[model samples]
Target: MGKPTGFIEYLRELPVDRTPTERVKDWKEFHHHMEEKKLRQQGARCMDCGIPFCHTGKLISGMASGCPINNLIPEWNDLVYRGLWHEALDRLHKTNNFPDFTGRVCPAPCEGSCVLGLNNPPVTIKNIEAAIIDRGWEEGWVVPEPPAVRTGKKVAVIGSGPAGLSCAAQLNKAGHSVTVFERADRPGGLLMYGIPNMKLDKKEVVLRRIKQMEQEGIKFICNANVGDNVEPQIFLKEYDATVICTGATQPRDLPIEGRQLKGVYFAMEFLGANTKAVLDGGAEHALISAQKKDVVVIGGGDTGTDCVGTSMRHGCKSLVQIEILPKPPTERAADNPWPEWPKVYKMDYGQEEAAAKFGADPRVYLTTVKKFVGDEQGHVKELVTVEIKWEKNEKGQFIPKEQPGTEQTRPAQLVLLAMGFLGPEQALLKEIGVETDPRSNIKAEHEKYTTSIKGVFAAGDCRRGQSLVVWAINEGRGAARECDRYLMGYTDLP
Candidate 1:
């Protein structure tokens, strides 16, 4: 509450991003910086509500309603309004271990739950958050603060994504020797490989944080799969405690007709290979290429968007994204009121780029693949699709019902399955004999992080199923606090 009338005086504003056409040409971040005065004005829009739901991080209607890490929203808002960016960064770091990552990638449930959003637009909390951390980095305010003393205990984190990184970071801050093992060539599991570089610059943002963590005495062992390359039993013997943050990576498959076609690939396979080639400067080794091809991406989430963006960069001649669900309302519907995640339609970056090039939004909602029609050489040449409607089954379950006479075919040389992940791969969990929930996620209660076995802990997507980076950081920090408590008699970590 830097200014009492701030919300009344200022309208919400975000930094301008490069035009879609221009940004599609390169794999760099698009959003530019806002001037200090305008940024402070955006921060001032945060209403000084007596009950700030923006920071509550509660679940409403089975969806996250605010900052999942319970970031001190108002305090930082006030700090940003007062132009105390370093202080704002400090406050942000108090709860979220990686605001840099979240600021770029998070869907900002905080804005959805803002008190001001009941009528006016919500405050630009995400933009202000990114600004604070970016300012910290620019001013050299952020640095490694390794623990002053050793706890004489060792902990092993099995993933290098947000959860594993945050868990390793917090545990190391508690004076424990922490080691993170990542199977990828470099660290930052999904952050490094799963996501495209343009959305989150791998070198400047992700790896920079990793370098600081390394300087803080956290050891990252890359290209090491704990359950396969190394043994799970070895962790039990070598380390005093082991925290498994292996993310939910088992991608869902569309087992339709002609599934074995040459050009068909999992979304991760495409995204992962594209990122690897981009980083390694070896585009020739890319697993799949959308260049000069008609591409069809199946699904309509962030991953699907990534596929579209990546395809656009590869100079795909034509592209279409098929989504099984119906299109969302342009604005919040009557059933979706304030303080809940508004299930509304908003074109994301990839769709924006696709629309810029293709002259229309590429999504075909309420449609799904019937089967693949391939050429004589076994390459996908076209997709047979059918329109569908949601209908209640005998058991009162809503399922897709193909509408009669709604079948059609579209040319597609390459088909990328952007359907979401099922859960963590079961190999490691089964090898370690960890219990699993009905969803096939690790059977550990939320916030506790304890597995069925003593001295073993699980967190992140592996424990909670596929989720946002913000949620992963929340679970990671929570797991670290619990792990610290288990190792020592108490934990000072929040």
Candidate 2:
């Protein structure tokens, strides 16, 4: 609303990123900052719609349609446009505890549902969002605001990923003493290790927020794994309430032949080790390196893309990513209408890097790895793949059918499985006697976030299965709200 014709006048623009060829040499963040004037122009592109769908936060066709945390998109857009920098940050913090993380990582479903996207390109919500928070940090406006008075209550948050951080943050804001326990050597759980450093820098961005949370009086206990060294029952005994945000760490495995080869590794295993090496003064020699190797990534998702990017940084000789599903259409098909996530084709950062060197996209659609070929040392040397076609079975379920004469054997010294996660690891839940859904997730209702066990709550991927970081933050805040109500018999958290 800052400029009535802003939507019509401004075109979509994104911040320039480091070229794929040059950025592949190092692990630094590739995204660059846009000048304030250009950023305001991007913010002005947000149409002052009669009914904004950008923040509706609904699920359509089994995918997120808008901002999962219901971010005040229009308000912040206007604030940024009108040069009310502080006001914009205030509005962003009202819903999102970490705009910097979301702006960098979240897929921005809000853009898919933008009203302006019906005709023209949607507003540059993601870029403008990142700019606003980055500016706040540069201006020193972001600081810890610990609660004024303690409520004399204590809460324990298990895990320190996006959900755990947001949950602990909100619980701390409610004037309750909050403690977050993470099993990792460093905090941030998935944020710390699951994602590569290039996507979310640990020291600069993730840890910066962690330091602020420490200042806000939230205690983080690292290397305190509940089911192993630290007793799970201690939380039930020592804290008034407990919220489990341990996320879906159990990765899905491809149980194929030669899976036991020494060179084959889980996506998390590869990504986690590489990030640790990057942070620990480049001790990458101790960890597995894709340097001078022909790497094959099994599964096509963000993790697969991360593998490609990480391998490129390690100076891999070649790269290939295999996908079981067919390639997505270039544009939305007949069934994929507006307000739903657009199932279209777009190359991510990893593919960009791979293509920059290899001269083509590294992904091959409708292909599945048949088996891996290993050398005498039990190290993977090659993999055989076969093209497949989806066909309906008698039960009307589509299943992959191998296409004859389509098998191809390719060189592969390392293989990373990035299919996705199954659910949260079950040892701690079983140790605590918490019930789990059939899907192996914690049996907690949405919004309420309470488990069958009294005084126990669950949220994020642990409760809802594998999802985006924005959704995890949404669940974290929602779980904090319910936990507050349960403890105090009322709540004011939104």
Candidate 3:
């Protein structure tokens, strides 16, 4: 422990965010870093508890409770408090291959399970983590560490998202020649396209890491869709082992009336096209602008929140978000206790900006859209919605029951569906002959990570269904270790 009484002496502090009005004008990241001295003070708040539940990486009540990649939270915090940033970065990289991505996007289950958070605020672990990695980049501490000896084994990773990148990185470190295939024109999957640039700078952060991985001998082939452009049988014939990490990209659809309106689009379609256009020298083509339009985003999740933020940047005239589920409590309910991720309401960046501009949060809970009303031009003009109540049907399945006299019509120029993904697209999996679970996810044991076919493994969203980036990294590393074991009949990777 850097200071035995540090937790008692210091309260948690975090980086400040740019003001709503100012940040909404640009697509750059809005988070401002704290001073080095104050950041050290925040790191000092780590109590170094005897158990240190923050890094346990366990699941409780079906939700993650700590760092999913098992980062050495206390050790890194102590190092940061003592101004040992390079050492802190080294320790942070020991488990997590990409702390920058998780630091920005993760919900921070570690903070929820922090020993200090039982009473006071939790240690600024995520902030400290981002600081360490950013410092490492600035100081030129991060570099390619290619394995010394070649194993003469080649592996194919069929995705370029966090999971695929992590798997390829680890396998390369184990002296295996690894090649990653991405169907998109660019790599990084959702990290490159699904996410907006303001949240994660594409060139500065993500592509920098990609360059380093390439230098470390990991090959990334873009615009190659296995089972389509590149034959799946060719991979099985050429590579010694194949690891599938294609993320859950299949979007859920709203099958209501007037669904085919020109102005309506899937959340990914809007976000992806906008990002691609931004990256293409700010081209007008493939861009979805919300300027002077009334926008309605369906579903209440991260993707929905991203839509809210993105629309605000486009100078939308009005915005409304609808959620079928009831609003969460402001505080943890009696059913949700300590050490579990709390199901409570919090204003994310998008809602914060919307509230600042519109005078209230834009989300309306327990509301279901019945149809997208369109004009003579075939563009969506309004949304017909009704309040709903959850009731158990004869089969005991909870279904939405429309409440009487609760119907309303709201004006809208654009509607984005963000209800989440179904599963990985089935074309590649079917061509590869991998079995899928009942949920349509690729069948693979969590620990072994082996598919029904020998020499083939699966991980990440494709294997585990839609999940967070941290879980994807965890499964990727686990699958890499298992692949190594299968190649050598034993392995040393953790």
What's the lDDT for candidate 3?
0.92
lDDT per residue as tens, model 2, 167-210 = 99999999999999998899998888988888998999999999
Model 2 clash pairs?
Answer: none
Residue-level error in angstroms, candidate 1, position 170: 0.3
Cα RMSDs, all models:
1.0, 0.9, 1.2
The 0-to-1 C-alpha lDDT of every candidate, in the order given, reads: 0.92, 0.93, 0.92
Candidate 1 global Cα RMSD: 1.0
TM-score of each: 0.99, 0.99, 0.98
List candidate 2 stretches off by more than 4 Å.
none
Give the alpha carbon lDDT tens digit for every residue of 1-494 in model 3. Answer: 98889999987888779998889888898888899999899888998899888998788898899988999999999999999999999999999999989888888999999989888988988888988998899999999898999999999999999999999989999999999999999999989998898899899899999999999999999999987789999777999999999999999999999999989999999999888988887624556888889999999999999999999988899999999999999888999998999889998999999999999999999999999999999999999999999999999999999999999999999899999999999988999999999999999999789999999999999998888889999999999999999998998888
Candidate order by TM-score, decreasing, is 2, 1, 3
Candidate 2 displacement at residue 248 in angstroms: 0.6
89 in model 3: Cα distance from truth in Å? 0.7
The pairs that clash in candidate 1 are none
Task: Identify the superior model by TM-score, candidate 2 or candidate 3.
Answer: 2
Candidate 3 is scored at a TM of 0.98
Count of clashes in candidate 3: 0
